[model samples]
Target: MTGARTPCINPRCRRTFKADGGSDEVVCGKCFRTLAEAVRSEHRRYWREIRKWDRRILRTADNLKVTRMAAIRDRLSWQLALHWDAEIKPRLIAPDKPESLDAFLEEVGL
Candidate 1:
């Protein structure tokens, strides 16, 4: 027998899907896969940007006093947190996705 029909939970894709009797999924298979891929891509991009910043910070640290280096590290941490909260947090849709960039990097073994 065909399962009950339900609409995808993704606001951008509300296409109706057959709800499996044994599953509680709220999104269509296609949308779920697409969202998963998008999240992965975003994670990679965020990591790359973080590495670039790390390289720059290290280069600058060589010529800076200990106090100035600490300040730079603090500023970089604040900026990265702000970007993750304002930009990356909203796009995360996967149920098992990491809630923070640090967690993501850890998950990927980077």
Candidate 2:
């Protein structure tokens, strides 16, 4: 049998390693750098719904902001950023996905 090797998310340090399961790993062992990061990339991967909800909000933020509804747009931006840093960002595990960091964050809910 062959061990599964994946690349780390950190562009500056995109290292690879072997693991039993999981495809397209968000961060590698070395690139994770600290306990906090590891938790975000590993611990938070369990939540699928939260990530999905966040992605939709981020996909059209700029366009939504420039639309007629200014107040609502601002509120959404603030909440998204806040929730990301607090709830979603710390649990990310999809660094190399097709969507931007925002969508990836949503996909992983980390």
lDDT against the true structure, per candidate, is 0.59, 0.53
9-36 per-residue lDDT for model 1 (tens digits) = 5566658766656544354556545544
Candidate 2 Cα deviation (angstroms), residue 1: 14
lDDT, candidate 1, at 66? 46
Off by over 4 Å in 2: 1-4, 19-21, 35-110
- Per-residue lDDT of model 2, residues 60-92, tens digit only: 567654353445445555665475455533444
TM-score of each: 0.31, 0.27
Worst 10 residues of 1 by lDDT: 86-95
In terms of lDDT, the poorest run of 10 residues in model 2 is 88-97
By lDDT, who's the top model here? 1
Provide C-alpha RMSD values for all models, in order. Answer: 18.4, 16.7
